[model samples]
Target chain A: MKGASEWDRHAPSSAPNPRHTRYHPRWHRERIPIFWWVGHRRYTLFILRELTAVLVLYSGLLLLAQLVAIGRGPESYQAFQGWLAEPWVLALHTFVLLGLIFHTVTWLNLAPKALVLRVGKIRVPPRAVLVGHYLAWIAVSALVAGALVWVAG
Target chain B: MSPVAKGAGGRQGTEPERVTRSREPLLWSLFSAGGMASALVLPALAGVLWVAVPAGWVAAPEHGAMLAVAAHPLTRAAVSLLLILFFFHWAHRFRYTLYDGLQLYHLNLLIAVATYGIASALSALALWIVWTLG
Candidate 1:
C-alpha cells in the first residue's frame, strides 16, 4: 500500500487519485458500425425478419384501403380491384406474400421459446408447442380461405 | 413480482416488495399476439385479395358478396383487431430494431413515442374504417 503516488508518476495521467488507475483505466466501449448486420447470414436473416414488419404494416394498410374502397360503393371497389389486378400490383403483392410467409414461419419457430406451457408440473414439450402453433395456423388459414372463397364468394 | 419475492423466498421474513408495473409486458404481449394474429391471417387475406383474386387464380367474388362479408359485424371485428394488432406489432418490432440496429438509445423516448403513437393513430383509423364500412 506504500508509494500510492506510483500511478500518478506515470506520464499522461489525468486521474488525480492513484487508486483510479490502480484499479482500472477509464471504461471504454467500442462503437457499433451502422451496417453491422451486413454480410452476416444469421444477422441478415434477423433483420429480414424485422423488415417483415414493414410488409405486415403494408398489408394491414392495404386491406384497410380495400375496405374503404368497398365502403365508397361498388364502383369504387371495382376501380380499386382494377388497380390491384394490374401486373405491377400483383408483383408487389407476390413479394409481400413471400415476406409474410417467412414471418409466419419464423414466428412459429420462435413461439415455443416465449410460451412455456405446462400441465400440472409436466412441461409441455417444445416440439408439441411448435406443432400446436402450426396446426393453429393451418386451421386459421383454412377458415379464412373458406370464408373468402366459399362464404364470401 | 419483486426480485426478493419473485424468487423463492429463502430470506427469513423478507416481504414481497411492491414492484412498479411496467407496460413492457403489455406491449410485448401485443407484439406477440399481433405477430401471431397477422401470421395466421395476413397471408390468406393478402394472397386472396392481392394475388389470387387480382391475378384471377381465384375468380373474383361477386362485388356485393365481398362487400357483404366486409359489412358483417364479425368480419368487421376481426379486421379491426387484425389491423390494430398488425400496426402495434410493427411499432414494437420497428422500435426495437431502430434502437438496436441504429443504436438510437440516445433517442429512446422519442423513438418509443413516435413508434407507439403512430401505431395508435393508425389503429384508430382502422377502427373508424371498419366501423363505417357497412
Candidate 2:
C-alpha cells in the first residue's frame, strides 16, 4: 500500500552510496514480451477465452436491440429481421456462434475445478463432473427448445 | 514535530492510491456468475435466433408472439438479470484483457473505470428496456 511518493523516497539514491556497492549475481527474469500470449499455446488459449467476452457483449447488445425493435411494433421487428438477413450480419453471427461455443465448452470443462463433489467418502472424478455438466446443459437446452416449441405451436 | 510523528505522516502519505480501492473480488464474482449463466443459456439462444430462424430451419416467431414473450414478467426479469451479468462479465474480462494483453497496468484505474462504467450504463439501459416492454 505504499504510495508512489513513499516508494520514490526510498528509491535507490542517484548519488553513489558506499554502503550500496555490494555485487551479487542473480538470474535476470525474462520480460513479458508484448507477444507473450502468442508464444505459448496455453496463453493463446487463455486470450481466446477472454476474447469470447466480446462476443457475449455483442450478443447482449443484439438482444437489447431486438427487444427495442419488438417494443416498436411489427414493422420495426420486420425491419430488424431484414437487417439481420444481410450476409455481413450472418457472417458476424457465425463468428459469434463459434465464440459462444468456445465459451460454453471451456466453461463446462472448468466446472470441475470450481465444483467438487463427494459422496460417502468417495470423491467424484473430474470426468464425472464434466459428464454431469454436459448432461445438465443438454437438459436445459432441451427444456428451452421444448418451451419454444410449445409456445410456437 | 517529533521524528515519530513525521514518520507516521510519511507512512500515511505514501500509501498507494489503489491499495484501498481494489474491487477484484466483486468483479471476479460477477464474472464467474455471468460465465455460468451465459454457458447455460447463450449457446441455445444463438442456436435458435441465429441458426434455426435465420437459416429457415425453423419458423421465426410472429412479432406478436415475440412481444408476448418479452412482455412476460418472468421473461423480463430473467432477461434483465442475464444482460446485466453479461455486461459485468464483459467488463471483467475486458479489464483483464487490457491489463495483460495491452500491458495497461499503469493505467489500471482508468481502464477499470471505463470498462465497468460502460457496463453499468448499458445494464441500466437494458433494465429500462426490459422494464418498459409492453
**lDDT (10s digit) by residue, model 1, range B91-127:** 9999889977887765666678888999999999999
Q: For every candidate, how close is chain A to the native chain A in TM-score?
A: 0.82, 0.75
Off by over 4 Å in 1: A1-26, B1-21
Instruction: Give candidates' CA RMSD values in order.
Output: 9.0, 6.9
Candidate 2 C-alpha lDDT tens digits along B25-130: 8888889999988888888887778766776667778888889999999999999999999999999899889888977666776777799999999999999999
TM of each candidate vs. truth: 0.83, 0.82
On the 0 to 100 scale, the lDDT of residue B13 in model 2 is 31
Candidate 2, residues A51-97, lDDT tens digits: the string is 99999998899999999999999999989888876778877887888
Question: Candidate 2, which segments miss by more than 4 Å at Cα?
Answer: A1-29, B1-22
Report the C-alpha displacement of residue B122, candidate 2, in angstroms: 1.0
- Chain B, TM-score, each prediction? 0.82, 0.84
Model 2's CAPRI class is: acceptable
- Measured against the true two-chain complex, the DockQ scores of the candidates, in the order shown, are 0.34, 0.43
Which candidate number has the best DockQ?
Answer: 2
What residue pairs clash in candidate 1, if any at all?
A: none
